[model samples]
Target: MDTVADRVKHLRKQLKLTQTTLGQCAGGISKQAVSQWERGITEPQWEALNALQRACGVNPYWLLHGTAPMLESEHTPSADATPVGPSPPGHPGTCPLAELLDDLSRRLAAADPAVRDEVTRLVLRYLENPPAGARIAKAIELLLGEDENLPPA
Candidate 1:
C-alpha cells in the first residue's frame, strides 16, 4: 500500500476485523478514531500504535514508516511450512465460512447504513435465486467491472 491509511485498512481487512473491532483490539480506542486513521484525516498517536502492535501483532515500523513487514515476523507463518495438526477452534482454517462472514461484516461496518441494508437485501435475493455458471460469472463481472482478460462465461 502507498500510504499509512492504505496499510491500516489492509491490516484490518487481513485480520477480518471491523473498524470498531480493530479499535477494541488495539486497546479500546473509538471507531471514529480508526475511521479517521483509515481516511488519512489523522495519524494514530504513538500510544495507539504501540497498542496495535502489542494487541494485534502489527509491526509498528510498518504501520508508521511503511518500510517493514506489516505483521511481526514471529506471528506470520513461513510460506514454505505446512500446518501440521488440527486448527484451533475459531481459527480461519477450522471455519472458512466464519472467516468469510467476518470479512463481509468488516466491510459492512465501514459502509453507510443505507448501503449496508441494500447490500444485505441484494445478497439475500441472490441467495434465493442462486445464479449458476455463466450467469454467476456475468454477475461477478458486473459487480467487479469487466476485466478484458477474463474468459467468456
Candidate 2:
C-alpha cells in the first residue's frame, strides 16, 4: 500500500491536476508546500485535511492512511446551493413563494456570480438582524405588487 504522501500525490496526478491546482482547492496551500507534504517531509494540519477532503471529495481517513476506499458515500453540499443558519418555515413543497425565491436566486446566480455573491452576502447580513419594519415593508410591497429590488415574493 502507498503511504499517505504517495496516495495524495498520485491522486492529484491521476486527475491531471497540477500541485498548484490541488493547493488552490486546499484553500491556502502552495505548490512547494504540497511537494513537501507529498514527499513525506510533513503531515497536513487537521484543518488542511478537512479542506482536502471537502475539495477533492475523498475520504479524510483514506487520504491519511490509505486503509479505506477513496470514495465517501456522504459528501458535503455545495456552498452556493445550501442554506445557512436555519431552515425556512413550513414544508418545502408546500410554499410556492419560498420555492420561487429559491428559483430566482438560482437564476440570478447563473446570470452573474459576482453580483449574486454580493447580493447573497447582503441578504445574509440583512437576515441576521432584520430591521424592525423590514418584514412589514416587504409584505406591503408584495401586497401592492411592486417588483422593486426584491426577489419573487
- Best by TM-score, which number? 1
Ten contiguous residues with the weakest lDDT in model 1: 81-90
Q: Estimate the TM-score of every prediction.
A: 0.47, 0.46
Model 2 CA deviation exceeding 4 Å by range: 73-153
lDDT of 1: 0.61
> Per-model C-alpha lDDT, please?
0.61, 0.56
lDDT of 2 by residue, 29-81 (tens): 99998898889897665446556666676555567667446755454435453
Which pairs of residues have clashing backbones in candidate 1?
A: none
Clash number by candidate, in order: 0, 0
Task: State residue 140's C-alpha deviation in candidate 2, in Å.
Answer: 48
Residue-level error in angstroms, candidate 2, position 123? 35
Best by lDDT: 1
Task: Provide C-alpha RMSD values for all models, in order.
Answer: 15.4, 12.5
